[model samples]
Target: MTRPGGTTIKNSRRLKVRVKTGKGRTVSQKTWLERQLNDPYVAEARKLGYRSRAAFKLSEIDDKFRFLKPGGRVVDLGAAPGGWSQVAVQRVKATEGKGKVIAIDMHGMDPIPGVVIFHKDFYDEDAPQLLIEALGGEKADVVMSDMAAHATGHRQTDHLKIMALAEAGFAFATDVLKPGGTFLAKVLRGGTEGEMLKMMKRHFESVRHVKPDASRSDSAELFVLAMGFRPID
Candidate 1:
């Protein structure tokens, strides 16, 4: 028998809670439960008052790449639950009156201090311009995208959906990023192929894929980091 908070279970295949007994066991449900209970980053995120463990994912990724900085203006796409926005707000010291963070999501978010949040579909024709205006008409120093489409359990379909989101994110970056600015977006494990990478290569001086430690080991998610924008005329 384990006491509450005594030896927090490490991620394992067998640590799942069965809601209904007998032979109805589900592999995905088991994996998810075990992973959630055992994830150290999740615990740390709670302790540090972050909205989700994903905050630490961004933190770790930015630690390696150093895209976010003091006094830097940033935009967070798909900023629901505000974990990434919380991280950005703290890193840029928006509370200290130095920098700004503009976050958008289709899902509603409880207000995060020092972060400006917009509830709307990012694909709406006027949304990007509205975000720019909300930032007092300033170009962003960094743009981060964690937007992912609802999974349809079809691997190829999910990949295409996520790639489309990334492409839209890149388009926004092209419009708003300063010459030396950075763009980061969540991608699948193997990185985008063919025309996608080609397009990123043309627009940014360097592009790389990173898997932050805070992300679950089994997750296919990774981030695509783009540095030094070269927008087409």
Candidate 2:
């Protein structure tokens, strides 16, 4: 549909650029809204029927690495709003009865077909075991973590918090992944090339850091991809 001004209305949803004349519109909030409005992934997400644009980050990363496969068992850490969960379900064919996806997050998530979601903290004493059991006693082939701490606006502190979560996710993956499995987690640039990298190198055949195109260029976030898990003890 084309409007009188010759602009296409492909989606038909009203797109607005509301400017505040006065009050209730802070500079930061306005900037955030503008960014969201202009983001290509956000627009593509709506057109592709995804819950959130973050889905593209996972898709792009998986596309390059080919970590997800049909009939593969996967665990999604920090899954919320079912964005990544949705993609995992379709890619792994969990709807066809050949695979399972166990998603864990502290936040409540709307239901997604072919995904078993656990609304609990992954660090809870029994959460890891519960997720493993929910997979019907089968170890996971791929463990993916998109967990991030609530940013405190302090750069150093925020970095440390995200690293802590990544470490916890790594620990859970190590406990439940089968030999030759894979682990992927979000981390800051400063978080890698340290003790965590050393530990990953010892446990996996290869560890690579990736920044997907969907990720913001200014963001400090990157993903750590660990392939070929080697179970110790």
Candidate 3:
């Protein structure tokens, strides 16, 4: 399949995987299992040793935008399971000591080579200061968030929840990002709106919504990429 970055993902057609509704399995559980078993991205992620299939979403985005460059300092908000951090580490050459990747999450994550993990909720009052201190008082070249709220199964509720996280992430980005830095965060299908949209336009040279091939076609998820940060005087 052709992705937005003009990269073609080659996958051989395979027989569909089916799951039986067993004694302990609910219908939704069985459906989710079947989908995971049949997902090419999941299989490929396992083969490549990525922490999760979501890695491809960041990969596809960075491939097109070229923001995660070597020697860049990146702050990843809500980086649990560390998939995006893994990609960022390699892309930024953190392992070679040329860059830095600081990943923050409310939940604990196993360590990834060259990544500094903060097991704390970003909503905590002290979180921003901690992250900035970890950066040695230097501004970040990029701040990204793949954070999403737990789905309540109500569409509008879920959308609002995720948007709240995105907005919070953007606010934090403005504080830590160097001039001309990038901000990337996950959002729902309708994209950013109202004052948030206007703020992004004023602060960024360009802002756009990107849906990567790694995102399920039926999923409401999309990413907002705001590049070239222009902090106000």
Candidate 4:
């Protein structure tokens, strides 16, 4: 038996909904489904009309860091499903003409009121140029990414893939961010590589790793936040 603050389940009156194993459903899939069904964040996301539970992760981060400011120019890399982009639009007041937000991802998403969307992969040669053009040559105040490469079940392999994405996002951030800009990207828990950490330290006054409470405790995910960017001429 479960309740979302005594909330009802989707089209159901029962507080505790059970999923019995079916003929076609595998054990692992059944387990995953059950977890999703009961997850408070999932329920909350639905209630709030957020695309995914990931919206809370970014919202939680910004709540503490206060980086998504009004009138700021922002970019969101690999922003599909538009959860983070939605939050950015609200915080920056983009629809209200207070700021601009550009979002790009390989997969297309429905339009968000205040975000400029680019339906292309970040690794494409044209991606950077597109973001630059969208920004109208203005430097970005923040570049944030929650993108993750497809996970292989192997922990080490998955870690390496995510780190690769993080490193790429960092490189892109370096080119696009204004002086004193902020960069936020997801990384694995093992840690950011020393060389990359050193490079970030050189560019930003403070570089710290964050694990928001919204993240699942069993997951090794972390976010690297670099603030007060120092652009080298």
Cα lDDT tens digits, model 4, 59-145, are 778888999999888999999889899889888999999999999988888998989998888888777777888888888999999
lDDT of 1 by residue, 171-196 (tens): 88888788889999988744454467
Q: Please report, in order, the local distance difference test score of every candidate based on alpha carbons.
A: 0.81, 0.84, 0.89, 0.85
Q: Rank order by TM-score, top first?
A: 3, 4, 2, 1
The model with the greatest lDDT is 3
Q: Tell me each candidate's TM-score.
A: 0.86, 0.89, 0.94, 0.90
Clashes of 1: 0
Model 3 segments more than 4 A misplaced: 1-10, 191-195
Please give the range of 10 consecutive residues that has the lowest summed lDDT in model 3.
3-12
Residues 24-85, model 2: lDDT tens digits: 87888888887788776677778777888778788878878887899999999999877788
The residue pairs found clashing in candidate 2 are: none
Report clash pairs, candidate 4.
none
Q: List clash counts for every candidate, in order.
A: 0, 0, 0, 0
